[model samples]
Target: MSSSKAGSSLLDGSGGIQPISEPKAGPRYIYYRIYTKQGALESNNPIYSNDRFISRIVSRSVAPPHTAACLKKHIFRIEKFELSTKCTLYSSLSDQAPVEDSARLALRGISGPGVSEIDPVVLVVDVSDAKKRSKVTSVEAKDLVEWSPTRRYVYYRVYDEAGEISSKTAFDDTDSCLGRVGTLCISPPYTALSLKYCIMGAEGVSPDRVCNLFEDEGGENTMKDGDTVALLSDNYPGVSKEEPLAIVYALQKDPVNPSEQSNFTKKLIVTVYGTWGDYDHTWHTTKAGEIFHTDGILLKKPYVTDSEFACYAAINSSGKKAFIHQVYSSFG
Candidate 1:
């Protein structure tokens, strides 16, 4: 009957008062915060403190072995939310490109330890409606053309300063006039500069050397670096196996003296094939069926194709100077 408290007897059996030991460390976890939005993804400063926040997901994989598709499934399983066909996953609110289903989360820089609340992976589930709107806001507001995602091949030939075609079979086969440099796979939104870099890599040409790209071997149509493959294909639709895009190696030379401006007398006229709205103030809005006249005085040199616009200064019909973006107009 001298049974003091059973709990006290158990404690005393171990020692006077053995300190409670901490539990062993558990598996590290990675955390991701998800949100659902109903509009186009913003490029910057997206609202995060809103009620759109869905839930946080915990994962044991530090490197995040989950692919985007797997994460989508996990989100659906945990949240019990059904996603539409238009729904896409973005790494952040500002991500322009949707995360591919096969892309791993770790490869997209979305992995971290869940020790603290800081620096958790943020993902946006873009649930924008894909149905076309019934109402018309404005003619200019409507998107006339969209960037295509279909992959296409571009045939090209490289030429030396002497106009001799390169015999390198790095691409496909070769013909007499145009030796097949190679077939470059071009998807929409691909720039001429990017295609040029690909061609240079295949040809083993030094990047420092100036290379001129032309739609034809005659060099009548100059392909600016800022020009998209879509625009080039639209302008020159006949690019095929029989006729390859020409690439000429330009030799570095002294800049033309300002006193030598008298020799530059070529007047180039541009026609707008499609309506171009002025999003950026650098150029004026142009109508679809209007002719744009140029004074031939290139305030900015057109040869600098690496520039964002690849446009030169020209006098409009009203005698006012304007910077015409090359993408919106076709040279006549």
Candidate 2:
């Protein structure tokens, strides 16, 4: 008859959700509290409405925020749009499973009301009737692209996948062609290289989720870093002038302040490339300390819906998830 037990009955019967991770035992000592806001207006002081981390009150109609769309997208902020860096982080408990996340991860990157749209809209969701509130109307995440004291534009490429985009073999083999360019407009530029590969899903419903490259395409081994492939939607821009399988363009983000800069991305697409399928990508993160992701394993095309690489790490475990995407310089 404790609070967790009582709250458990109301929301999905799971009341004891822990924070992403516990504080580690080390010299870096700093204590902080987490506060959640339902209808905009966040206060600097952490607000625990019920006033307790260990409450038994169930999530009465309260819904959680989408993970990736919130914090991952705003990995960096800058003063200029075109001169900005965009990023997304994904991890899965298993290469063959869903991403892991935590309570803090759930509340990672939330901006004020109408202001949410101006944000990149990364971890997005339709959470209505969220916890004690009636009729919660839609939620989108935003990250602050603040400028550091330095004038350098912020950029991150911690999770770049290096390989064929897909291997489903559904597109007319003719469409499988792509090119690889490295080190475009950036300072201290070198060969920021990661092989790019792409393939389409099989031509049918439930076509093995697109990431099951070799198995779906009847190959003994999975496609490797240098192989070229195509997907069902690879023909939008014509066939591959570079490789065997066709390729799709990577997702693009407008300068939060386009008036300032005009940078863009060219990574190949993992989902059905190019049409309106871009919005389908979403993410989930794990509690802190859970290994962010294993190193050196790039999931070129791993049968994921919407191409949003999903990452899952256990709270406090390193290398929990196993996906990697590298960053490099490219030329037009």
Candidate 3:
């Protein structure tokens, strides 16, 4: 008989009572190799060992077009069954409904003497996980002071403490409230003059100097040659007066050493009149394409839990089985 047939016969009824080798005692481990979908897909998948929850494997967006990357290896030490257990894969998407069989993965532990021996696994999620991480957080809005006013806009200095921020809202006059000197509503059709004054004031640059930088003969919609553009605007209710309306600006980097800049390249400025739930606000830029945020709270709050904003979780390859956290979907 061939080696395969002979091996099968060893487990047959006629071969009963054959001598067997005992499993070695002591520590054992299972290492995993999981493969996600080809593009950047956001996923918050949990991993289990021996039917017990051990860690969560999350994929991050490293590039555009659904391309994603996840933990290379998951190492779990045996606990009850000689430091080894069968590993089954599960994703948060399964919580919604019955997951397709093809989306699931089943892996059996392979035992070895030490670090050299390991069990590898590949897991796939039922749905593509593509949620971008939120960068909004609680902020401290201090004061608002006027700077310069153009023919169609007025500039003001906004004093803000919580520098970097984010928002999902579209930039519009509605849903936003910019506190004017009269505490009047600075709503839609936001004049270029209003945007310029706020940003120039925030930059501590003289509002009158705006004319020196650029000239605009065009009406409300046309931005001056060197004038800042409004990016996003919204009104966030429940904001306390102590932390009133704020303007978050993302400035251009100093080309010499861009790496030294802060993550958001942000500057927080306050509006002159204190902003309330109805107070409107707008984020402005001297040039187009620079990022900015408004009408949102800070990323971290005193009472809110981390899970609310945390979008990605990665498992450490060490024996401790530690977890690493990353902000939003940009993979680290």
Candidate 4:
């Protein structure tokens, strides 16, 4: 993979892609390539052997930042190769990005049907980088972006429940706020751990499966610090690769079914890991049957007028069953 392809000056020995030499070792970069064997775009990234892994195939200017993306994954692969050279990169829209985000949000205390979440790392905005000529756009909960706080950047889900994209403030608290909100971390290749509402989530509405969104809008706060965010369904993340994290979701009791019964209610819990911010985080259910966490506690939480009282549940750090199942208990 490294040797120049014979007879081809531009390519290496096997006629594979080649990296232009850096006489001075420019800024540093990581390259990803796409070798199409067939079909439309792929569902997974490609694999490259140690001998075939082209670590040297990249430009120095934007190398380091780009390589950082593959940090969690060992291989960025042949398809990712283009990512190395391409200045602009979009996330895998289908499943990879959603599952990752769903996992992040699920662990953060946000779960239930139709909840499309995202990693907070991608929400980051570094005002310090204003000089880098980077334009800031409110990242979608659906976009494939990551965050690095050490680099003074963060990925935030800034949109409102009404489907309004978040606007930014020049205030310095942006950094500290993200940090206090658990949206920022100090790890070396540090990244944000935030979640967003997944717009393209499961559509199966089971009668026995209780979901509290529009009816439970802006209510319920059961998340605490040090807990996980689960991206799952009661069947917790069905078709989410059927992975363990894919099977995590908040367990709703009481109104487990039969919406006609006024005594039925909804709650939130973590069935997955690293989907939301943390257990200490508070949450509210929207009219859309989606759950969200917030640092700003609501004065008088929303409620269902029906006789059915709802409660949210989650496995605490100590594995205790915690929930705000009763409206009266919640107020107290």
**Span of ten consecutive residues with least summed lDDT in model 4:** 34-43
Clash-forming residue pairs, model 1: 171-182
lDDT, candidate 1, residue 321? Answer: 39
Per-residue lDDT for 155 in model 1? 63
Name model 1 segments beyond 4 Å from true.
1-152, 170-189, 231-238, 252-332
In lDDT terms, how accurate is model 1? 0.45
lDDT of 2 by residue, 1-332 (tens): 78768787565556755446755432211111111111111212212332211111111112345343333222211111111222222221011121343323333222221122111112111112122223221222222232222121111111113434422332336433222111111101010111121112112112112232221212344433223222212331122322222232323333132122222122211221121112112122222122222222333434233344432211112211123222211112
Q: Tens-digit lDDT track for model 1 on 49-134?
A: 32122224455422256677776666544443444423356554223345787887643223332232232334444222223212
Instruction: Compare the candidates by TM-score and give the number of the best one.
Output: 1
Which is the winner by TM-score between candidate 1 and candidate 2?
Answer: 1
The candidate, 1 or 3, that scores higher on TM-score is 1
Mark the regions of model 3 whose C-alpha exceeds 4 Å error after superposition. 1-21, 24-27, 39-119, 130-332
Model 4 over residues 1-332: C-alpha lDDT tens digits? 33434546456655566788745423322332211111012113212221121122223232223333442122233222222221212221112222232132111113321122222222111211212332232433344333332222222222223332322321344332111011112111111112211210112222122222210112333222222333221221111211211111245344322233233233333232221221112322112222322122223322222233344442232223223333322220
lDDT of each: 0.45, 0.23, 0.25, 0.24
Clash count per candidate: 1, 68, 38, 76
The deviation in Å at residue 213 for candidate 3 is 52
50: Cα error in model 3, Å: 29
